[model samples]
Target: MNAPIRSDATPRLEDYPYRLSDNVRFADLDPNGHVNNAVYASYFETGRVTLMKDPSKGLVPDGLAWIMVRLDTHFRAELHWPGTIELGLGVVKFGRTSVTFDQVVFSQGRCVASAQAVTVLIDETTRKPVPLTDEVKANLKPWIRRGLDLYQRD
Candidate 1:
């Protein structure tokens, strides 16, 4: 993974605090010549990890971790090789014990895929859900996109 390529020409994504860059590998392509569907999931995972590892912006504690509970994805365009892909990650909703993420994959400034995931924090020792601290919630507030609240309609 690499740092995002930034430019004034790039449109500001909703409210992503984290952006990760990844080059499309030959092995990522399927027989159809486009990146495989499963590869998209891995890309999203990479985005999450990059976001979580940032000491200033990440919330994954030393002894605790977030686990993906669900993921909903939509493939809008086929991704080709010999290109760099940018992934944008933002917090859509913050819950007592879970956090929802909204992510998008872009290639050459074109939106390739979109995904939403719900992840819950758990104590590594107890393997049980842990409540989000106030500090963590406050830190994540700036990344929340007001109208993109998915997986929590009610």
Candidate 2:
């Protein structure tokens, strides 16, 4: 099971250890003149994929792959095109076979959306869930969200 999202607290970009910048494309705008709501998922994906897929991160093993199993999203504000946006991600919990992340999208220093995403590590050939290795857990320690009691809970 995944941890519940703590939406009562305000999100700060610095609290997330992993962050990246992306531009809002013209095509992302909806008929209402704001960025389409669905586009926020891709921004969150960029943050996770960039960190996990990098060889130096050592988060993924050679024969294993990470697949998203759940994403609980909260849309907080409207976003317009012709601007840049910031994405933030932090590891919130580590399950026996899955990892959960707290991700946020910020535009002009204000949070536009936030989500709690769960991804499972699976064997490529068998397509079965695999238990997380100690090494992978250690590698993710640096990316935990600050000011959380994750160590004691998980």
Candidate achieving the largest lDDT: 2
Give the per-residue lDDT of model 2 (tens digit) for 36-106. 98898898999999999999999999899999999988999999989999999999888999999999999
Model 2 spans with C-alpha error above 4 angstroms:
1-5
Per-residue lDDT of 31-148 in model 1, one digit per residue for the tens? Answer: 9999999999999999987777679875777788888999888888899997899888877667779888878889988878888888998999999999987777777766665444
Q: What is the lDDT, from 0 to 100, of the residue 13 in candidate 2?
A: 99
Q: How close is each model in CA RMSD to the real structure? A: 7.3, 1.6
Give per-model TM-scores: 0.82, 0.95
For residue 36, model 2's alpha carbon misses the true position, in angstroms, by 0.5
For all candidates in order, the CA lDDT equals 0.77, 0.91
- Residue 139, model 1: lDDT of 70
What pairs collide in candidate 2?
Answer: none
